[model samples]
Target: MKAVGVVVEYNPFHNGHLYHLRESVKKSNADIVIAVMSGYFLQRGEPALVSKWERTKMALQGGVDLVVELPYAFATQKAETFANGAVSILDALHCSYLCFGSETGDIAPFLHTNEFLQKESEQYEEYIKHFMQTGVNYPTALSLAYQKISNRKDTLDLSQPNNILGFHYVKAISKLNSNMIPLTIKRYKAGYHDKDFASTSIASATSIRNSLFDQNADISSYVPNDTYTILEKYKEQYGVFHQWENYFSFLKYSLLTMKEEELKSIYEVEEGLENRVLKLIIDSHCFQDFMEQLKTKRYTWTRLQRLCMHILTRTSKQEMNLINQHETSPYIRLLGMSERGQEYLRSIKKNLKLPIISKVSGFHHPLFEIDLRAAATYFMIFPEPLRSRLLKTEYTTPPIRMSY
Candidate 1:
């Protein structure tokens, strides 16, 4: 069975994601579309509004054939590292292609750019380094470097989140030179952060999420009928993200109470970001305000989010180095799979080199418990009735509950 792979967060599955999942398999002409998904904490350095299990079920029911966990280490990282982690998993899955949604649907130019960067264009590297040293943001640095290297007058907009991630995917696939083909589907939404959902049938997840909590907009129009029904069942149970401010305070306290050197240990704290964080978090009122205070032109909000995630995950410098050395997701942990996914897994599981671990705790590895402990952090922050249930939510969290 030929399988196409997608790297996703599906933070809460929505129509746009469903569109991409369907399009990926259709475009690849593959029997299954396997997704390497983010866990409890997303890349944005925030707790998933909904549980990962819920998201996985939504993906399986919506379109994806299989869902596997993308380690938090890779999931909450810079674009390059994120792509690397996702791509590495796909490579191990023996997938025939890697697919993603992009603002510029045209794959030719992206492929062209990917090939160009592969030669280690001296001018590009120099241009990028120069911009970085200026403390210009990463997105801006890339745009500047692209202009210098391509010498093309076309305005390369790296500002859009999808485009930036798409570029990283292209770079990663090119760098690895793996067997997987690269595929892109046009993103249905105009922008990643558009808070307004138009009635155009395809709405961004951000817009759907915003409308869900917004007092005015009708969110039922944005989600699938099934999702709409499910959400209604759980709506009252949900907490506004802002309600979790006290949790962030707990985290800040956890940090400040620790030794100065201990604060420096988390992943992405390489240049003393932790030290800056200590002074910064105190002056700022809320978590968002604290993050805003720490933001830099050189560091994208996404990068800072990862920094926050690194601290939350307790990822030490040693762990970061260990992960970097591996250069690929260590294991393919199956969260859930549909009939087609099972067939695909059976077909490719033999050819894949990495271990495919289904049960999280049964596995006697140190990493298994560590990931679960991190997942527990999710429960601790949201003190809902679900927290009791989450304590029992193990690696054995069954084949997802799906409602057609």
Candidate 2:
């Protein structure tokens, strides 16, 4: 059985995702689809609308044959790190192809862009440093650097979010010397950051999430029935969908109680950012207000949000640095698998590079410990028995098996 891999967050698994999944299968002509999903926190440094397990059910029901957790260390980082971690996992699983949604939809541009960047790697770094020194943000610096060096009209636009990730995915595959063929499907109607329901059926996850949180809008038409049902069940059982604003009070508490030195130790807390946060945190009322006060030209909202997430979870620079020393994750955390997925894994089990972790009972690794802490922090918003119950599930639950 051949398998194609996809990197996803599946915050709520909507129509766009369904389209991508089905299209990936058709384009790759693979027997099964495997997804490496983010756990708790997402790439933009916000809590998932639902938990990982719930999202896994959505993935399975949506047609993914297998689901694995992308450790927090990788999930919350920038596109490069996130892509490296996810692609490495797929390569470790011996996948035949990696398919992603992109703005260009053409795989050749991603390949060409990556090759161009590789040839001018040193010059690209110099350009980025020069741009950053002029007060532009990292993303802006990257775009400027790429524009400065990229002479080919066929190269992808690095400014677009999905395009940036696609470029990085292709880059990672080359860096790892993996044989996985890269493929892409053009994103549907809504853009990555679109916040309104522009399309009748296809809507961005951001738009869906905003609608849900802003007015309890019905998103049944945008997502699959299974996704909608799971989301409703999660909200009913947990009292509210998870979001950054939900944890603002706790974040404020953390900011208030921690010493300056302690805050400085957190990952991404650099260049006197700890001082800015410590000074601004006292006067801010909510997460939004705090971010507004702290936002600077050099620090993007996504970057600051990731820093805040690291601080909220008490992740330190030392820990992140130690983990970065490794090229890939030590273990492949199996979140869920279908019958076909199970059979495929069995076929390749002996030749696998990483251990597949089905249970967390005695799993011991520095990186895994960070994942555990991230889960605990994610569950901290819930009250009493529910909080304890969810945390306990993290350790006790086995891989979700789908019979169909």
Best by TM-score: 2
Per-candidate alpha-carbon RMSD to the true structure: 2.6, 0.8
- C-alpha lDDT (0 to 100) for residue 376 of candidate 2: 96
CA lDDT for candidate 1: 0.74
Off by over 4 Å in 1: 152-159, 237-246, 364-370, 384-388, 401-404
C-alpha TM-score for every candidate:
0.91, 0.99
Worst 10 residues of 2 by lDDT: 322-331
Tens digit of per-residue lDDT, candidate 2, span 1-404: 88999999998899999999999999999999999999999889899999999999999999999999999999999999999999999999999999999999999999988888889999999999999999999999999999998888988899999999999999999999999999999998989999999889999999999988975488999999999999888878788888899889989999999999999899999999988999999989889999999999999999999999999999999988865787577789999999999999999999998999998987798889999999999999888988999999999888999887
**Model 2 / residue 271 / CA error / Å:** 0.5
Over 4 Å off in model 2, which ranges?
Answer: none
Model 1 lDDT tens row, 1-404: 88899989875677777788889988999978889998877776766666777778777878788898887777777788888988988888888898888887867767777766767578778898899999897668978787766754333356567777887887777777788888989887546778776557767767776676575667665667766655665555554432235357767776777677887876677677777888887777677788778888778787787677667667677776756786677787788888778777777766877888876655654445556766877777646676667667855476563332
Model 1 Cα shift for residue 230 (angstroms): 3.1
Candidate 1 weakest ten by summed lDDT: 238-247
